[model samples]
Target chain A: MRVVYDGTFEGFLTIVYELYYQKLKPTVIEKSALSYSLFDEVDTLVTDETKALKVLQGLQKWWSRKNLQTILNTFMCDSKSFEMDLLKFIRLGFKDEKELQNINHTSVFAIRNLEKEFFRHYHRMTGFVRFQELEDETLYAKIEGKFNTLYYLGEHFSKRFNNQKFIIHDIERGLAFVHNQESKGIHQVADFDEPIYSSKEEKFLKLWKTFFKSVAIESRTNPKLQQSFVPLIYRTYMSEFG
Target chain B: MKKDIYTKMQILSDSAKYDVSCSSSGSDNNYKTGELGATENSGICHTFTADGRCVSLLKVLLTNYCIYDCAYCMNRVGNDIPRAAFSPKELADITINFYKRNYIEGLFLSSGIIYSEDHTMELILKTLRLLRHEHKFNGYIHVKLIPGSDAKLIDEVVKLASRVSSNIELPSNKSLKLLAPNKTKEKVLQPLKLARDISLERTDKVIGMSTQLIVGATPESDRDILQLSSALYDKALLKRVYYSAYIPVNNHKNLPALVNKPPLLREHRLYQADWLLRFYGFNWSEIVNEANPNLDEELDPKTFWALNNLHLFPIEINQASKEELIRIPGIGVRGAYKIIAARRFKRLGFDDLKKLRVSLKRARYFITCRGKYQNEVALYPEKIRYALLEPAKPKQPTLFDINYSATTGEL
Candidate 1:
């Protein structure tokens, strides 16, 4: 038997809700698999916010706040064998309150490692995501992230860049997080126009460039060390590098 | 008549780069009252410069004018360099603009002593006040505390700045006397001790002071440096001590020649030892003492210690306590905790450890999986040391050598 739902984490939780109430014993769970055995039964469910909420509330009762948060964060990671492993992890957690402490368990161990990688991705992009002033004074930044961290950045920057109108577009996924200090939205777009620069934008950029250049000690120049910090993968989006 | 921001930034930051305390971690001072920028406790490094240093803060001096000529300093009063000073308004303006565009995490304001220590500190305070009160910018502000400045001024600085440090440049008292006549041990330690006491009095959980120690500038051994650091941490409640391998910036008779390059690996070793002191539950006496004055350049401080004390090794992976687990080579603080947590659920073996991504190259020799030693290498310390030795690389450090980052056993 196969189980399927929308790719969102909440969708996965909605499936988790079915797994308990409906007594599902799925051989496989996925956002959508291209193929399933013809004889295999397929159970498809749309994402239900209420069902997800119930699953979350049930988890809160069983698990510590930290473990529950880890569950959500690990789910953010789209690892291979992800859906089945998460299902096993959740099942084990349900069986024992101390399951996450059992880091030797394969499913628990995998989720824990993915949690680290997920946070590393989230933190790096949040730090490296550089904002520029647009003509009308909207702070705009872009990131070509390997993870779906655009949503995370929205919450972070909205608090960090208080009262500032801003938009952070992940051009790779054609997704943008727009915040107006009071409200926030994540929108998908096919294309985005290059923003017009503010009058002082050029001057500030030049000053930043000068600071970057002058701060580096000439004798201590280590391109490889610099490479480790600002890797090739992130250079395209960052203004300091090419 | 006014110098542009670019010229001031270049000159000021170039002078400021030598004091190498780039960390903007801990202390939740930012974002409580700021409309412009927030210093997330986990600070951001927007970029890394060519020297491979983190560009987290706008690390710059307010002015290069100095009343004291410290021999190791580039901004020494004797050096005939281009001089400029930022009006408090100018520095604050530059900081806000760069911060808005997310070029930096916050401002690291350092300055050369001019007129008096009070005058220099007041200028820094003016800049901080403008950012924190006027602009409502509550980002991470790391200010340099003037040694002989007024107690009231230092107290005000402690309250305002997120973190503070007074650089003790050279390691020993004699070296300070030889190189920097204007500075004394009490001159540096007094302000740091005051800041620590002030922060302690206000918030019991607070750690607000650090100092930078210069390596290779003088003949002070690693033992001397680590001893100083350990004492500062224990006695004065010093939070951190940054060791900058002496990169000769000035041509004073007292200082080393420019030809002797920055002791990059030695500095790397000191940092490794410092990490052991702070996190790995190791003491200075245990890591370095009378017998071994310098850290072994070939092996890391931990590996060196492990080799020296082979009797303690072969700690059972499944059964060892947290203290025993951390002492084993290659198992960092995090790795040790991971082992402790995992062993309750399952008896961890070589396979389980491998799956957890623990660095077992050196660890396999010292640790046993279910009382079974994992490595083919003999239990004898000499044999294990030879087996563990990484194939030697050239001594001459380059601009891009990536080997300097030996994990100071992950925090």
Candidate 2:
């Protein structure tokens, strides 16, 4: 049987609810946007807030809060098979008492690896996001990350630039995490035009670029090693690379 | 040359790059409600330079002008290089601006002494006061304390910065006198001890002290370096002891030739031995003794020790204590803890050990899981050593192998 739902995390929990209530084993768990085979029986699961919360509460009893968050972050991997993989992990989590903590299990290991990759990308974005001081005296940064990691990056930058207003725009996802002093929220911005940097901002960027270039030792020049640490893709957003 | 701020930054950062103590860890201060920055316990590397070194902090010198002509230093007084200095306001502004952009975790401010040690240190203190008070920036700041500076300056700077260091440039006292005539061993150690004492008394933001020692420049042995490091950790409560391989940045008859490589392998071995001394509870005497004065470059210190003392091998994994488990070559501190915790459920086998990420390729001869030997053959010390030294797998065959395989199908 094929199960389809919206792409949000709540949609995933709705599928888990159907798994227990309907007593069914889904052969394919996919988003509603994906096309299914004609021979397979398709069931589109609607996201019910109450049902999703109930399933989350049930999983909390057996698994840890960190484990539950890991499952949710693993769902954000954007791979084709990530949904079914997370479903298999949650089903295993519901079994014998200590099964969830067992790292030897393949399903558990798959979700753990997904969480690792997601956080790896998230942490890189925290460093790569370079904010420019706009003409209005606000800080702005734009990133094109591989995953939907703007929310996590937002929490880090918000706590840091608490007194100043800043905007972290995820160009690929068309979302911006805008924090104005004490108030912060995510807004959907369809297009972000070229930001205006004050003359002082441009000068600081030049100084930073100069420092980055000069700090490298001339004797031990290895581009391969540098690329291994900060890949070429992340450099596009960094001010030093510019 | 009339250098602008950008050119001055280029000169100062290039001068500061050789000091390889870029770590920003050991601070767990989160962002205050109205603060502009925060620090993580594990530290964050924003980028890596072309030399494969982490660029965690904005490592720069306040000036590249110096009075002391240290033979190994690039900014020595005798060198005919362009000199530049940053005003107190300039550095504080740069640090706050960079911290906002997430370009760095903090500022690692070191400076070449222009006139006197006290004068340079007071300039550094003025910059720190500007950052902490005027800017209200609460980020991690690691400043280097100038040796021979007054104790009052050291106390004030320690309270302002999150961490401080007084680099003992050379390991031995004789080397310090030979290469650095202006600096003595006592001058360096006095500030380090003062910082440690002041930090121990305070319960607030200050976190101990750290120091750096340059290797391969002097005739001091690795044994001497480790002995100094062990004492610093024991007596001074130093947070870290950085070992920088002596890169030939200048030419002097007293220093090594420019043709010689910068003893990078020896530097790496010293770091591994340092890790063992700090976390593995190893003493300097155990790692390097009076008889064996140098660490083995071919093998790590732990493995060499394990090979020398084979009578302690084949430690029972199920029954061994955590300390014994760590002494084994393959099990790290984390792996030892995992084994102790997991063994409470059931006796672990070889497969279970592999799941915990134990290095069984090296551990097989030394450890036995549940009394079942990984290698059933009679273990000879020389044979096991040779087998371990052999390459894990043969290098990928060249074009000749394809020709040989095509002709020798034997169909």
Candidate 3:
């Protein structure tokens, strides 16, 4: 049997709940739905909030809150085999009746590595988000990150820019995290036209570019080392790079 | 020079680029709702420069004019470089704008001795006052303390800025006399010492204090530099000791000739040993003795120490304590904890250790799996030393200034 979830923790937990309750063995668990599969019985799970919460509380009994966050980080890695990996990890945790992450198990190790990979990208995005001021004084930025990191960055940025109005669009995913000081929401933005910047925006951009270029020591110029710290993909939206 | 903000920023930032303390990690200043900025505990690097240095803050000098002719300084009074100064208003404006756009975490303000030490310091104070009170910018600010500034001024600096540092570029008083006749070891450390005492007395959030030591500049050994740092940490005067490879910017007869490149590899090795001192629970005397005053360029300090004391090694991986575990090569503080945690579930064999991400390459020679050595290299010190030699890395010829030397005042 195949299980399709809604690409969320709650959805994945609902599938886990049904897997235990119905005693169904799933060969493939994924976020995408297949079109008209003849051989395999495909089950699409509607995210049941009660079942998801129950599963979460069950996991909490065996693991600390920090370990639970690690599991969420593993899911956020968005790896091809993350669903199966997390499933095996959850099973191992219940069977062992202890924290499986510290157990030196293969499945646990794989989940931990994926968690590290996800945090690495998320941390880089926190540094590289370059916001330009729009005409109405709203800070605007666009990102095309590798994973669904939009969910994790909202709280960090909201706390940092608490009083400012800003819109950060995950351009590749067609989603925008809009914050207007008091209220914030993640909306599916189908048509985000090129924005008109504030009058002082150009002047500050020019000054920043000048400071960036001049700060590099001539004798210590190494493009290779610079490239290693910041890869080409993250530099796409950075104003100082070009 | 009658310069625009653009021209002044370029010159001032270029002048201040040599001050290689780019860390913004120490302070997490609480942010009010309508405040201009907030601080991250693990400070964000907005961008990496072409030199591969972290551009965390808008590092710039308040002014580049000087009256003293320090032999190693690029902005010495005698040098014919273009001079510029940012008025208090201009600097505060730039910091606010940059923080507003998320281009920088905050400002790193340094200046030369313009007119006098107090005069230059007061100019820096003016800028910080505007940034703190006028603009309410609560981001992480790292201001360079001019060595001989007044105690009152230092208190004001601690109040406004999130982090402060005074560069003791010359490692010793003898070297100070040779290169910078105006500066002494006492003068350089006075403000840092006073600031620490005041922070403790007032029970305020004692900000991070740091100093820079220019490696391969004078005839100071790694032992000498680390001893000074260890003493500073003992007195609680310094949270960090930055090792900048001596970039020969000036040509004085007393200083090293300008032909040699900055000791990048030696600087890199010192940084490795600095970690051992601060985090790995190694002392300066253990790291280097009178027999070997300098760090070995070929092997890291930890490997060198392990080779020197072969009797301690081949520590049982499963049974060794945390201190003994960190002594083995290729196993860091985190790796040691992983070993301790994983071994509780089962006895960790070589394959199981590999699963835990421990490199058995350098570690195999130093560690044994339940009294059974993994490698057949015979566990001889000289033979293991020959086998464990790191392949020399090709020099990048660029500044890879990553300092992991800060500890309590955490990493």
Determine which window of 10 residues in candidate 2 chain A has minimal summed lDDT: A97-106
| TM-score of every prediction relative to native | 0.90, 0.91, 0.92
Give one digit per residue, the lDDT tens place, for model 2 in B167-284. Answer: 8989988998889998899988888788877877887434657888998998889999999999988874588999988888889988876645567778888999999999998888
Task: List the candidate 2 regions with Cα displacement exceeding 4 Å.
Answer: A32-50, A60-64, A95-98, B204-206, B337-344, B355-358, B376-378, B392-411
User: In model 1, how well does chain A match by TM-score?
Assistant: 0.80
* Residues B239-267 of candidate 1: C-alpha lDDT, one tens digit per residue: 89999877777888887766556777788
Q: Model 2: what TM-score for its first chain?
A: 0.88
For candidate 3, write residues B36-124 as lDDT tens digits.
77898888888988878889999999999988888999999989998999999999998888887889988999998998889988999
Q: A64-124 in candidate 2: lDDT tens per residue?
A: 8887788868766664468877887888878764666665665665676678789988887
Error of 3 at A151 (Å): 3.1
Instruction: Write down the lDDT that model 3 would get.
Output: 0.85
Candidate 2 lDDT at A56 equals 83
lDDT of model number 1:
0.84
Candidate 3 runs further than 4 Å off: A1-11, A33-68, A95-97, B390-411
Model 3 / residue A82 / CA error / Å: 0.5
True contacts kept of each: 0.73, 0.67, 0.65
Which one is best on DockQ?
Answer: 1
DockQ of 2: 0.48
RMSD of each: 3.9, 5.1, 4.4
